[model samples]
Target: MLAKFLPGARGAVLPLAILLLVVIMVVPIPAALLDIFFVTNIAISLAVLMVALNARKPLDFSAFPTVLLFTTLFRLGLNVASTRIVLVHGHEGEAAAGHVIEAFGNFLIGGDYVVGIFVFAILMIINLIVVTKGAGRVSEVSARFTLDALPGKQMAIDADLNAGLLTPDEAKARRVEVTTEADFYGSMDGSSKFVKGDAVAAMLILAANVIGGLILGPVSHGLTIAEAARAYILLAIGDALVAQLPALMLSIAAAAIVTRVSSDKDLAGQIGSQFGSPRTWTPVAGILTLLGVMPGMPHLLLLSGAAVAGFAAWKLHQIERRPPPPAPVAAVEPADQSRIGYEDVSDGMLVRLDIGYGLVPLVDERKGAPLMGRITGVRRQLSKELGFVVPQVRVVDDINLAPYTYRLVVGGVVVGEDQVSPDEMLALDTGQAVGSLRGKTAKDPTFGLDATWIAPGDADAATGAGFLVVDPGTVVATHLNHALGQNAADLLGPDEVQALLDGLKERNPQVVASLTPQPLALTTLTQILRGLLAEGISLREFRRIASAISIAAQKSPHAEDIVELIRPDLGSLIVQKLCGVREPLRVMTLEGQLEGLLGQAARADTSGRHVIEPDLGRRIVDAITRAAQPLIAEAKPFALVVQPAIRIAIRKLVKTCLPDTPVLSFFEVPEDKAVEVVAVIGASQPAQAGHFQPQALPA
Candidate 1:
């Protein structure tokens, strides 16, 4: 009930404390009140020192900079209040300022003003020259390095996000922490200047109080020169000592904070553990004992110190020789082999590579496995190219498989399986080889080209004969890469699409905010993006894609409709990727009769269900396959240019048989580029340059 009445009390502390500091500077404080304030100043400085010693890392005390500013202001206020009381009240007595100041002046200096002045000057020098200056320099360097490293740290977070090592929320939290660290270091750099200024002010205030007291006391109170000097100088010395001691302590605290390195233990623990070794203490003990026995030394004190060090060294040696405690054993429980649960039949990994038991050495680091490195490289390269992180490939050994076999599994189904000799290299024949190799003949596991398994030492010989040779590890990795490329659409889901939108928000926030939930849901956008990836397109330019989706969403919510509307905008990007910047696009053009036939088939398939007669579909598939063979044999890239309405239908017809070949609509080809008709699909041979013409499709 009482807590309910304290409305806004907790929020008013900072403003009220600042107001009190101002009051102390303007108001003339009595001796009793000055004593209370001086004690408070000392307590705060000590508390700050203890906190700094206990901190594990600099960020653990992120509020130190602000605390430093307030504490310095508090000390300066005390100095002003004390100086006024010391000069005006010096003629009365030595205890005029307060007992706190009088005791420091009398007991510490023993009535000698000269010694007090020397001590105050030394404290000011240590604080201003050594501690404060070093801390300020450290803060400046730390701030500069942190700002310079910000971009690289951000890129590291992006890389980890793409690699599936960090979730979205984790990545966001790390970014926030990085930004806060930069702000903290930069603030500390500027705040350190305040402490340095306070040290300078203390010295000037001490001198002013003493000089003003000597001149005023004899003239105003009718006292003798010696009497006035003794009274005023003592009071001035007391005032300076009371204020400078706390100022020095605060400076040391600040230095401790900026110089401290990050560690798991506090300062005391770190020092104690590092020096606890028997080897370290034993040498010190010997040195101390040797010095203690010297004839001219003080034997009592020196020998006592040596005895303590020797005892510490003996204890440390005993600790180092102690054996660890034995482990406790537990009773074994019997197995229940017949029990079954849902976990026993859970889904398999999204992408898994299972190898035979004989090939286990390919993944073992001790045996120099190159397969794991190759797989990591493939994932890294593909992640950059495809604009998303690929999940880790789970590689394991299967005893049921053949000794030389490996399988690539996706969604619990094996998509590709092959056999390779674990100790041999595969030499592929690209149809221009001149010499023969003595080895077992086979086809390349990735592309099904004619290849032979040969000895590793015969690699140079095979290369000299126009054969491409690769090790067994390369063979498995290439097969895995090709399989993943074919099914990249399957890896993309709502999570990946959301990541792409978040990245876009960094550059264009308005588009992502308006398009995602307000106009189009994530599921619809993911389907469209997956469709593009399935057709062998990169989503790196997702900012443009999002803008296109925002415009298309006003008319239709269908993924297929949206994709068709955006295809023209992305046409140049797609074409440039397939054909390099220098070469004209080589294409296999459909004959006039064949183009008309596909148009009729597309009209009959208005539902986009690919409805066509079996005979007609087979003829078209056979013709495209025949035309693509020559290009494949010569290692030249080509796309089949067709009418816009029939592109999707023909893609469906040939996707399963010729997965690597691209089918493009006329709009996808850039107008600035020239087209070369490499072959005619329905013709018997290559088309002549004068006989071939690419016909435009009817809208």
Candidate 2:
């Protein structure tokens, strides 16, 4: 009860007293001056009140009497200065030099009064700064206030609910609890609370001033006891209390308006949105202008302006608080109701219906499903109208036929469709699965070669005869047929052969270099050829032996021999074409022997024989030249064809030797005919190089 009336009542009382004083001021000269005095007094009082309220600590009054006495002295000094200036100079002209000097002296004597008023104004500005900076602090203060008061408010609400002050639903509705935004102004620093407390403090200050003046006015200023007492009471009431009332009212009104506006959720959001706009600050400017223009009672104008600004802000918030219309309710349907399936629709079928979000899956299903011929016809018709391709049809069932059951999958999960309509199942045309199987058939060398050389088949059944497993050297020799255009023996001399033998011996000397008992270093043999060519050996010999070694490596059962024989000569170009020889530089070592041979041959005569060791050199050169003839002849037409064949044969031979180990084939044969083609080529080629290119055969 006290909180409700105190603020408003205090607001009204001061204004009324000021009005009475204004009336009295019109009666005489001294009274008119009283108006100015009252205004300054009020301004000072309000400033002090604001400072006290905004301060971090509570006001201390232990020395209040001394402060009051000092304030009295200050006011008296100011009054003397004013009187001297007015009396000595008069309104129209400058006073005598002596009189002006005396007035200046009086002004100096009254300096304390002027300083006090300036100090009060400075305090008010400080208060404003504190409120602005400590916005969070203000909120904390408000929260504390609310918490202290909540229990009583909650109890009141509970009592109302129990007393049937509301219906069951209304009681359950619960009071709309206030949040920080609702309780505090957007300032967030608790400025509203500070303002409220300042207004109350202003009223108390006014009351104190009135009482103090009445008691002390006679002693300080020259006046009769009764007149002094009357003047003091009037000064206190009119200047302090009366002038401050409007400011208090404005502060309370502003706080209430802000609270109400913020209580509306939509309004609060609008305030946030509009806060950045230029229009939001217009009210603040207007209020400040009013405060500046208004004289003695400026606090009234300032407070009124604040109140109006708050009200205007509330109005702005209201504009954004329009009620939204309720959403239209959807009609419920029975669970057993039949719905058309997407698959049942013809290819060209046009569908239009009101459906829920759940129905989208069915539409997607229809788009993916295969369509039958009848459905295809429908699709064509629809396509003509829609100017788009209709879904193709693949299968259809007449009414008398048994229903075809198909699985429906959504997101990879399969579902069963029972009694599905023809329209539900779309027909689709997919290409023939068999036509896609076209490929080259590889030869099965195991079927024709001697069983003793071939590893036994996985099942050991007497299903067919076993064939010999081609050596890596033999496979290489066969492929060399195209590159060398001659027998492998003719291209490889005793020296070249001896070099390969030495490299193979390094790994395992026990193994012999033959088609059946493939050397352990067949891979090294190929590597040596590759190296020789890289070292400037004429490709004539290297090409033949490398190709042959590749073929042999493909079929060699011995994995190590396959690797060593091919490792040397797998130079850049050949390695790239073969696909698996990754290191071109590493393969370069294989050509070392070939390079030595060329050096030996370059020094030889037209017969291609070296000068030194004429017989042995002659034999080596002749063998190489003869072996190179077939490869050189066929290279232009069959280079691509033969190299890969050699590589394939080598891969197969390697697989046969290491029956328990895995061998990766370099040939990229088609999936269907891979085994058949490999077998045919391996069997057709002889284990000896001279068989295919007889001219290059060793004598």
lDDT of each: 0.85, 0.36
TM-scores, in order shown? 0.84, 0.20
Pairs that collide in candidate 1 are: none
- Deviation (Å) of 386 in candidate 2: 38
User: For candidate 2, lDDT tens digit of each residue in 1-699?
Assistant: 333678758667645645544444333334344445535544654554443333322212112223323333334333333333333222222121123223322343342323433443444444433432243344456557656676676567555533324333343344444233234323323444445355345445544544554445444444565654444433333232232333443332232232332222343355566584436855685767677567776776677777767666667666657577699889977665377666555433122111123222322446542222223334344333221222222222234333323322221232222122222211111211111111122232221211222222311222222222332222222222222211121233333344334434445454433421244253455444433332223333333443546465556645444543443343333333323333211110102243345344544545422233445434433443443345334431111112222333322332233221112222322222212111112122233643332222233
Give model 2 RMSD, 1 decimal: 31.2
- Count: clashes, candidate 2: 103
- Give the runs in model 1 whose Cα sits over 4 Å from its true position: 1-11, 26-37, 82-115, 144-179, 211-236, 277-295, 299-349, 397-405, 411-413, 432-442, 452-467, 510-514, 604-606, 682-699
- Give the Å shift of residue 391 in candidate 2: 30
lDDT of the structure predicted as candidate 1: 0.85
Each model's Cα RMSD: 4.8, 31.2
lDDT of 1 by residue, 1-699 (tens): 223567667567778889999999999989999999999999999999899889988887899899999999999999889888888888989889899999999999898888988888888888899889998999899989988998999999988877667767789999998888888888989988988999888878877987888888888888887887788888888888888888888888888888888899998898899999888877787888888899998888878888888888999999989997789887788867898877688545688999998888889899877899999888877777788777678998999999889999977778899999989999999888887899999999888999999999899999999999999999999999898888888878898888788878988999998798967889999998998999988887888888888998888999988887788778888888767888889887677677788788778775778655777777777777766777788888888888888888878877867888888888888889778777666554444567663332221
